[model samples]
Target: MSPTATTPPVLTSVQIPCCVCGTMILPNAANQCPTCLAQEFNLTERLQRGPAGQKHIVIHQCRNCRRFARTPTRYEFAEHESPELLSICLKHIPALNQHDLQLVDASWIWTEPHCMRLKVRLTVRTELLSVVVQQRVMVELHVQFQMCPECNRDFTNRTWHALVQVRQVRNDSKKGLAALEMALAKNKTIRQHVLKVDTKKNGFDFYFLSNTHAQTFTNFLQRVAAMRIQRTTKMVSADNHSNTANMKTTFMAQMVPLCRDDLVLIHRKAAGSKLAGSLAIVTKVSSTIQFVGASPKRTHVSDSMMELSADQYYKTEKHYQMLQAGHRLVRFVVLDVELCDEQAPSGQLYEGPHSGVEKYALADVTVARESDFGVNDEMFACVTHLGHWIAAGDVVLGYDLVNSVGTDDWEMQEQLHGGFTLPDVVLVKKAPRNKETAAVGVDEQEGQKRMTKKRERRKRYKEGRKQKELEETAGRMGFFDDINEEQVDEEGEDVDADFEAELANDPELAAELLNLERDLAQLDDGDVVAEGEDNQLVEEDNQDS
Candidate 1:
């Protein structure tokens, strides 16, 4: 029957003759065409991903013994049209993105009655261009939370999830990377799913996207260059850093905080699951805690919500921010700090009061700062913050202090947690000896000398401030006082401000004035030294004569 003119053309299956067998067969095989069953070319549509945003490409394969073996086709003694031709060749293929193709389908063609032919097409779903630009890289953050010192036994119930914008995505080998980057500058959080990542690829360099179009990738590159620094530095004693011990498995991801609570359910292999112990809520978050306290020592555990929600007594305090869509999580709990005393000099460490009652102090307050790392004197400059100077060898309360590193960095971290910076007195030890040393006497005389020098430095600081003020006034008034006319002062003037103003205008005389000032200062210093030398020499000559 004749079809209507408006009807769409249907794609019918193609059939071919078996070149060698000279037999008729179905047009389609499992993944190949029947005629080419003996010799078929297979093009596979694999779901394997490359770098997430790089439009996925479908691999083409020729059907033969080797290529056909890979497919689940029933055709066994298949002969190929071209045995010598590479089955999986990148050529003889069309360039298409992941979404351009359809699902795995087979067809066939032939030449002589002796041979058959097979063709396979792989398919892919369409993708939204705007959505891909929305998110390119996922940003996951984890923080340990805590409550105010006044709050007793408090804990963060859950981690605060933020879809921080990772500015790397807008690039993705595109022509409009700059335009895309400029658009995303105002927005930070991105939808987690929007940023597709290929875990197989070690790194992703895509900037996150937001509602206000995507930002230019160039801007994100600039931001990454500025603020990133080593978040944590692990330093061992001078002797241990190089040769420190190694273990079987080093880094690991532990369970989230909720695992600590007894409210969690534990399942058995045979019987049904039951409600177990509670996690230790060492830290606080108004109502919910990161973990429930189950034991004396704090450990971590995490199971899927589907598995644990079966026994549902625990509270879920979802804040307004939690409603936003995101798959990333950041979990942590700030702990109640305590001072502990132990047996060794480096003993009595400040362990956490995690579940019930435990103690932990700045490593300094309890034991010593392990000095085996590369903490040398030249690398760190020691300056007294509040008129206190700590010596190298004095074991103040018992902890070891590094050369001039007055206190531990962790000690000051407490200040960020609503605590204040540590005082000079917090230094537990004089720090002259290692964990093996006995109480050695400190030189009382040296301590007194240190106090004397502090007074001198204070006096010097006062003089320096006064000098700076006078020089500022001299420059602003456009007049020079002899006291403020020291050669050093002139050289120290803001060159950028005066250089062009003076030199640009009086380019000729500026050089002379500078030279004359420098010469005068040199002569004055020389004359003073010569006069002293002459006096000493004259006295010596006279005494000899």
Candidate 2:
């Protein structure tokens, strides 16, 4: 078939006069020139009469926490170029909700951060008289420093609606308290509710904004450690007309007196006929206390350890006495270890509650006091459950019952139990190496250098106390500014060498501490940026038109 002949259509231009200026323009729906239409629909003038009817929009910002408030009811933590900040800016422009007007694009504008000004450029489109009009409008946000209600209450010493007083029954050893602190710091769900954490002489005092938070924290503590809680409430204020009263609740959590490696003399009646011996050493401390008999005669029965619940321990706490506290444990060097025969079935294994997947083998270990290693030839032999971890030449902490002073109750118990005799030494866990000493050799100059470095770290830690408090306060208020990864790496490297050494032995604990450290570093970096420094205005060039 022959293709139809085609001819090019001629393009025609029709001129039209501007409605206001009477200027000739291309034929279009508006029937007006570009200049007259632009003058009639002045974006800047229309924006002046829009929802935000001023050239400068005042944004209330908390001076202490650095959070912004767009309205009186709510405060938010928004970062530059973030969707949250964009939404906050758009909320001020109510004209965008009109049927004809539509939001085309929005973006942030860079300005001097120190000037406390934020600028946003918004592109909007609208239909008028069968014509489409698009315009870009600039909005200036003036930040006003104001203390929020929370900060004001904090400054007035009324920050907490509930107080948790955490105390340990035995204050001589801080091991239990340290573990409790770690537990509190690692749990993000619980830490978010904590307003302030104060270190007391015996333990820590946690403050919460609400009584429910305090109760949640107390329950968390019970799950992590062996502790008993007592609750009380006091009326803070009362309104007779409304029949309303504001009450502040207080929770007193007392941790168990016994800690890991503690040597205890249990009363025969308190033992409840389940325990074979009165003398035992604490093997683990969690929601419940686990103890293994330390008497030489009961070495065969050590595998079947006794468990003491928190409630039972508290009920009979007066009947039990600590013979040797963990803090007074003596250092011992392992001279030899002989693994005992496995008595369990071929497929069966004995695992303690806190052991997790670890498998322990009983062994007879010969140890000598580290102090008397070369000075004297005295040695002691004992049975320990750490056969999988302990080896010759390893240093460990143990109770030296030979030289330990016994209480009157302990002496009487010993006299009554003629058949049972306490072992000369009871070994606990392996000792954590001293990083300060291990890093430097025996050279005096190296030791001096290490000391100087330790002193410097201490000085830096002390100097940053005020700044840390501010950062911690901001963190509790759910405000975390943007942070650089490099800053985080640097902060992570400065961890205490001793703490690092201790954490090396417990991978799970180390992981928890790592999370805690990362969170703290982010808080620290945010505070550093907020304190008299230029705000980080992220420049984002990607915008839809």
Candidate 3:
């Protein structure tokens, strides 16, 4: 077959004249050359419609609090490049809200912070007549310095609308107040609403901007510890013309006097009731006080264990007298422990208010005062409930009933009537041991090595404290009602091995401490990287030297 003749296709171009420049160009939706369109068309003016009146915008910011007003009723704190600031800015531009417009890109324009001016560059695209139009729009932000309602109220004399006064009845030990403070620290909702925290001699004073916040804090305290709350309100101001009154509310929360390990002597009047007229030890303190019988005469079956609720305690507080406070416990060294037979009547397990988690065995323990270990050969022998935990050479905290003064009415009755004779020493809990003391039967070299390690750890701890102090000093911009960082640090330092052991033994306290630690970790997360960098730099300098 003969080869087919090759055919070529012809391409054609349609030319049009630009309206402004009078230049020949390809036909487009604008019907103009690129140069002419750039010179004649204004993207910003064309896009301005509806609520987008002009390129200039004004945003209100509080000069005192440094918070931006997102709306008339809402104020927010946002930094540069944050999504919150971007959202707040975008809401003011109504043209961007339209469905036909697409926001291709957005960026911040740098401006001096002192100038109080912000600028944003937005690249937008839209389609029209099968042709795409892209334009860059600049929006100017003018910061109007004005005090928000909250700031204004804060400047006034009556800043806070509610106040909370937390006081403990027996302030000898700060355990109750410390526990409450931990609860407050762990709860972000409570901390944010607290306008001010003032430490007093016996307790804390917390101020709130609103009554609702104060009420929420009061409820939290009730759930944390056993406390009685009394509420009162006073009229701060009255507006006769508007028929409105401003009232300030105050809540007083008094913590129960009883604490864990406390020895309580029940009064005679309440003796007729259940779990009364006898000496008891407080095993746990929460929204209620859990007591276990400490009387030697009471059999294991009749342990006389009971729970005293906050409300009931408050109603009959006078009926209870603290015989020995927890802080008064004396240290004792266990000389020996003779475990009694489980089948014996004296060794039978108590089925009363035991949690069943802790195993206890009946034993006759021989102990002597830790302070009097070498001073005198005085010894004490008693049957204890802590046989599972106590052993020879172990240290414990107990009440020296033999040496204690008989001041309370119950003790006087016991002395006069000869009804029952109390034990010479009643052990409560095992004392935590130090690294040096805990290490038993170590050679001289190992002991010296441990001592050197302990000294190094102490030095590092001191250096850390100094570093923390410097950081606090550098960032010490105090607000009107800011909490004292020093007090918080002191509280944290007070949590030694003894307190940690107590937390481990008590489930409720352990849970609260866990929450406190979690909150503290979150607060310090941002500083971790900076601290690491600082340590790395120090190490590098040391290596070079």
Candidate 4:
């Protein structure tokens, strides 16, 4: 027996059954078969669900600026695929074993205001066989909206942290309020912080959501209004957790009673001080009150030494003294203007609150008010404040002092030389009055209507004639309305010359002119024969004579 072929028994490879499912599998396969492993690991069915049964997210969103509430001072605008949305969506996700389950991919499918959808791919591993399989799960997210604190406070009820009282002690509260409103319009930040504005008789009361905003507003007034600010706080609540006291703050901004162009009388005692007493006109008031002389050539300027308080300065009833007041304004025609030949006076001459007016060269002006109406009521005016604002032929408003007394010798001299007292009138503004229109009546209206109709007819006729003339001229110049009307060849006719060139170069035009000449000649022949017969009769009668 050929030494019995020592070949080993035929070795055969056989498929092995999976440990879990007992199904045939490759020898190198994992412990479980593919179908069994796939059946064991199902992410779609085992995906973590929300504690509320549905993937829902609750967030506070501002309806006004469209922001989500996260912190007391911070807000975010949520979008369709924002990380904030993803974080909020998965906040309640169930935990998974990292060794067996892993997230492969996740994405938002569709997002709307009320609802959203998400797709997640999870790789799940079978614990027994270590077989890896992938499963995709769809998640539905429901969004519920709640108004943010800001929106709630803005829309329904308001809780303010600060109150601001802006008071202008001036009698003209409307003007002050108008200026404040204008300031609000120019600054957007101030407008945003202003929660409410209530108009009071003296000024405005403002409510602010934050104390910082109120402080900012008060600081702004310090720059614009020469105001005094006072701050006070009241405890609103105590927090045991923070061991802090919550307080509501109030800001009061008291603006000076005086304004630009206001005339104030400083006490004689305070004159040498900042008040610059006598009759001081307010040139500018901001942080400090600026004063200048009331003279025509107001050349001197000074600042208040001390803060002007309401009690320190007395209010004057001479509202008409300031040109900006408008009520005391009187229209004057410049009759004459003459430069003073004398040397400019020194500040010592004017004495109290001279405002350096003595250094300015003065001019004597002769004027008559329009109200006098050529009644020979002439007044002398020394324009110190607005000297250059007037000239000959200028009908301007002049400050009148007919009802007052002179303060200085310069004013007395003006009264003596100008035939009246100091500032009998000073030019302020130019006002021109037009001829008054007559009242319309039924008969006059009818006549006016007829006249208007006639005028319109004439105008139409004139316009039509001009248009026709233009069209005729265009036609005569061989300028046709349309190029299609041009009958000439590609080489157009030479229009530089007139009749001679046409007859010589254009045979058709020459033929037409020849026919016209022949017709005229035939008609002239009969007329000539009749004239010759009449001439022969006349000659025979002349020979008999």
Candidate 5:
């Protein structure tokens, strides 16, 4: 026997259930066992259940799944733990997730299973906060209008527009806007009203929630502004005329309305051509009230223009002054306005704080109708006067003012020197008794400002002076001004010693006192002498006997 061939020691085979398959796989097989490789588990279940008794580990289970293919111990779980710990443990699992979580954090994912759809709401409170919403720098804006902001009791406008800059949280997102609206609806201060919502490019978004008299808000003003369509850019000057020191900013717009027939007039002018983009509201003082009628001649322009809503169009000072006039809000049906053929420019009431014509001056308006209107740059037809004093109907195209755009408010008397340029058809109402608005002199405003400033400065100065005087007086009184302290005992002793020294230095008094002392000494001596004399006398008597 050729030395019996040693049999290779057979290795014990340990089978491991494939994580991917339900079948046991041999350790030495080059390929995964087909049965073990085909195993599957419910993913959602893997994220549901947490680790046993571990606070950080939550095993997650699928709603419809129970086990991993045929394996009994395989399932999904979601764990709850701190983000710091999860980062250390889940360092190897490749994953990407947008966590919708409230109290639960990412670290929880490391504890056995971390796959739970979480929804959460958080509320945060802070002290000494930044008050982010209130720090905005804003401008106060005014636009020429034929209606009043107060006519409908704009308490909201007044309280919101006061000098204070308010805090606001604005929602630019669609979902946030709806949520904000719902939240505002619950507020007692907010009234219930439905506003239309439109979402489109070149489309305006208008929605707002207002607080009438609130300020120092953490976040709320932007919600209120959204209700209005005007997202305006505003700039402020120094304190305006009002002592209140409010800044002023103005915008351009046209608020007049137009009729169906006017569209035909515009249509005829374009002669069946594209009419939408060609027409623009001309802001020139002379161009503002000029109208184009169906006949295309000197025709009076009515308040009803194509622009449905009131608009502010910057114009010559005259036009601004005119638009600044007192306006009375009148409601008329669309058809009734057409029947009237013309409407009066709402007269501006420059009263109270606005006692004078603003910086804008009166314009040199011509007298004319639609036919007399002149075209400037072939764009807008210029009409001299529709309702102004000249009463003549004339049309002149594009005329530049002395320095600026012409305003329609008041005409300089000099423009009348050339006589009427257009045929006269309508008469401007004769100057009413108080036609000349009481011109509040500019000096009055300036003087008032000076006086107010002077008075304030004087008050502050007086207060400072009084405080300084009191402080000086108090200082003069020395330490402990109220209660006086006793003089030091040493000082009293010195005073007494000085008084005694002065008494001793008195020459006459000292001499008298010295003589008294000499007498007392002689008395003692007298007694002794008296005794001696008696003895001598007695001896003498003895001798004589």
Candidate 6:
């Protein structure tokens, strides 16, 4: 019976029903067919983000600086929405396991400035479905234009916790404004801390969001200018329930009146201090005024060690113009310099500010006005006016001296004792002779008028002056003699004058003629060796060879 039954029973493949749809399916197929599973499975069932409702993706942004609130930090307007927008969209969409959903694409379309349409394409994978599902979703977001807390406070204009009033004692608003701008540019943190800047006639007002920031700007000013500060506070608001009050603080900063290069006299109140009673020249203006006193005796006035005031203990005696503005520097050649131990004579002393106190030696230099002749021109200037030592061959600037007003002398003597005299000429900066003169022209017509007067004066002098004056003028114009044919002496015969004129026109031939004249003069002076002596030397040399 077993042998007869050995024929294998007919085995048939049975169709298995899908778990999800109860439809016949192959064994190798997933739990459900693609179509049936797609119909039954929900793509958003596992979405961690809840369905759209009262709770939505809310974005808080600043209206002024355009910063968005991004949980931990406020993102700048320049930041491109990346994981931020993705995380935000996922947070609002109805989803359970966010990992199961993949955002394929997301775009924003501005319906209005404050409103945007957010379109997102999501690829969703479900555990029960064989095929991936893609869903396109859209939402309209109305960006509320309500100001952020900082913006609201900024717009209120009264929200500043601290105010700084910078007052310049000299009422120099330009300098104050320039200094403020420079300070802000130099320090990034200080600029950032500043909330508002208001310009005034003699000072400036700075408003800061925080008291510490206001103090920071004040400290910056203190470090850069000599100033004093006073602080005050007032209660602006109070909360009865919380027992809290808002206090508005103000910082008043007073800047010094003394600026760089100003000469100041110390009063009796300042005499007892290290910087008191001595005359000083301001060299720098910063958190404190810096000065260099008379050399070898009093060198430096320290800011940290002394308290200096513009009005009470100090007096600004005089202000001198810089080398560029006061005088047009002329070309001057130093012909000679005489160094002596004796003090400079009264007639040769520097006359402008510090005169007899600072001693300088005598020097005789030749000065040539820019419109005059070459470096060989002769005009004398003693070294006392220069206030500095000079040596031969050094080209110095010839600055016209300012006349001292005698009426101001009595007042000046009170500040500085001893004889003080203004100079006839001041030797300013030393420079090369060939440099082009920088003519500061205020008006073309005014300059033309001055030139016309100068030409008229020169014409009168040329037509009316005596022979001695003519010789002096001729000597001064030595550089032009080689270039101008008419510059030859008119007293010469016609043939000589003609020859001289031709030579002047031909510079190379004129140079050769001058060389020949020099050789002839050497011969007349017996500078040329005798022919017999030359012959004897030549014979001796020939015998030695």
Which predicted model would earn the best TM-score? Answer: 3
Worst 10 residues of 6 by lDDT: 295-304
Point out the higher-scoring one by TM-score: 1 or 2: 2
| lDDT of candidate model 6 versus the reference | 0.49
- What does candidate 2's lDDT look like per residue over 4-98, in tens digits? 99999998897877777888877777787655665578675555344446655667778898877767757788886678877886776656666
- Candidate 4 achieves a global lDDT of 0.51
TM-score of each: 0.15, 0.55, 0.58, 0.50, 0.19, 0.41
lDDT of each: 0.27, 0.68, 0.69, 0.51, 0.27, 0.49
Off by over 4 Å in 6: 1-57, 61-67, 71-81, 88-145, 149-159, 171-196, 268-272, 294-545
Candidate 3 per-residue C-alpha lDDT over 509-541 given as tens digits, one digit per residue, 9 for 90 to 100: 556666665765565675677889999999999
lDDT of 3: 0.69
Error of 2 at 526 (Å): 8.6
Assess candidate 5 and give its TM-score to the true structure: 0.19
Clashes of each: 93, 0, 0, 13, 77, 15
- Report how far off residue 219 is in candidate 4 (Å): 3.8
- Residue-wise C-alpha lDDT for candidate 1, range 1-545, written one tens digit per residue: 99667967999765555445645434433323232342232222222232343333232232322232222222122344343221321122332233444433222223352222233233323223211111111111111122322121123332111112222121111112212222232223322212321111111222122312123332343232211111112332345658763222111111122311112212122132221221122121212222222122221122211132211212221110111000011111111222122332332332245433222222211122233224532222111110111223323322112322323545223322232222221221122233333223223354356446545654656466445644433332222224444545443343223222322222223454455457556766897899999999999999999
Model 4 spans > 4 angstroms off:
1-68, 71-75, 80-84, 87-106, 109-144, 186-189, 268-275, 284-289, 296-326, 338-369, 373-378, 381-383, 404-545
Identify the superior model by lDDT, candidate 3 or candidate 6.
Answer: 3
lDDT of 1: 0.27
lDDT by residue for model 4 (174-218), tens: 333434544553455656677766555467677888888898888
How many backbone clashes are present in model 4? 13
Residue-by-residue lDDT tens digits, candidate 5, 1-545? 57877889988878876545545765533334543222221222222223342223222233433221111233333233434323322321111121321122232212233233322111212111121111111111111112222222243443222122211121111222222333343342432221212222212222322322222121232332222112233443455566444333211111222111111112112222221212222221111233222111233333222321112221211221121110111111110001112343333322335555221112223322222235322122223222232222222112122112232213422222233222111111122222132111122244456446545654656555444433322222121123222422231232122223222322233344355446544754787799899999999999999
The alpha-carbon deviation from the true structure for residue 119 of candidate 2, after best TM-score superposition, in angstroms, is 25
Once fitted onto the true fold, the runs of candidate 2 whose alpha carbons sit more than 4 angstroms away are 1-159, 271-273, 296-303, 342-358, 374-376, 391-394, 407-418, 432-545
TM-score order of candidates, top first: 3, 2, 4, 6, 5, 1
Candidate 3 residue-wise lDDT at 453: 59
RMSD of 4: 29.1
